[model samples]
Target: MTKRIAAGAPPGLHRALSIVEETAEGSKLWCAAAAVMACTGGRRGRAAAAAGLASVATAQLISNGVCKQLVKRRRPPKEWIPHDEVEDRPDSSSFPSGHTAAALAFTVAITPTWPLAGALCALPAAVVAVERVQSGAHYPSDVTAGAAIGLTGAWLTRHAPRLILRHWL
Candidate 1:
């Protein structure tokens, strides 16, 4: 699947995906979006931004810190990717894609508070998932696992406060 995507994607798409992946490094894209939402979007936007940021942080810690530490899978082979970006992939374990996790975490966290914004975020999140495979950074299963981790992070972020309150009250 990685080989087919790497080989089949056109140069234009490859360039676009590379740019998206680069922009997403360190969660810059999502942070910028959060800032925008906080500044321009009213109360709902602020809530969504907070949730999204929290989810991203949670997902990052789990996927990059814990899960990656436990799993020692290697990235897809360079030969499988036909692009220059393959050389830039990190040497970390590839059992889960941290980038995909962060992206999905942000998108899912914001959905309930701001469905339209969540819909907008979905496109890039999906792109990041595909780019992980296309750039030889992860296998499809890695991205899938990352996505699951992301959803879990979002769920925790969204419900933890309520659950804590319910327990206390």
Candidate 2:
């Protein structure tokens, strides 16, 4: 993983992170989802969006939890200074990044109804994953695994809303 970063992180990763971190842009995505749900009279749409958010959060936890426990990798050595360009500093395990996991999970959940939105979400996720490596907070492999966990969780969450409503309705 280190070797890969050493070789080179992807192009435009820094720029992508910058775009996502903005308060307006990031919040807009959430607002858009909320608006879409709200417009449908807060029935199935709202329920699904809420459930999807929870699923993404849960998936991030599981992914980060399992990976951290298994890998038990420490942060980069103190002597090692991260790439100057990377801004986010996460003082956690250097495996299966939580941010990447969360982003991918959210992307997965939103993709079905809003393909364009999902694609937009993915841009930041990819950048954040790369930033995790540049910031010395995650190995490339760790980000990859986190992404898998997130995507799987998002998919599972997608159908969970219907099952939940089935009982209550």
Q: Residue-wise lDDT of candidate 1 within 41-62, one digit each (tens)?
A: 8998999999999999999999
Candidate 2 segments exceeding 4 Å error: 1-48, 78-88, 160-169
Compute the lDDT of residue 69 as modeled in candidate 2.
70
**Candidate 1 to truth, TM:** 0.97
Query: What is the C-alpha lDDT profile of model 2 across 41-93, one tens digit per residue?
Result: 34655554665476566676677667677777676554353455433445556
Q: Which ranges of candidate 1 are over 4 A from the true structure?
A: none
The Cα error of candidate 2 at residue 156, in Å, is 2.2
Q: What C-alpha lDDT values do all the predictions have? A: 0.93, 0.62
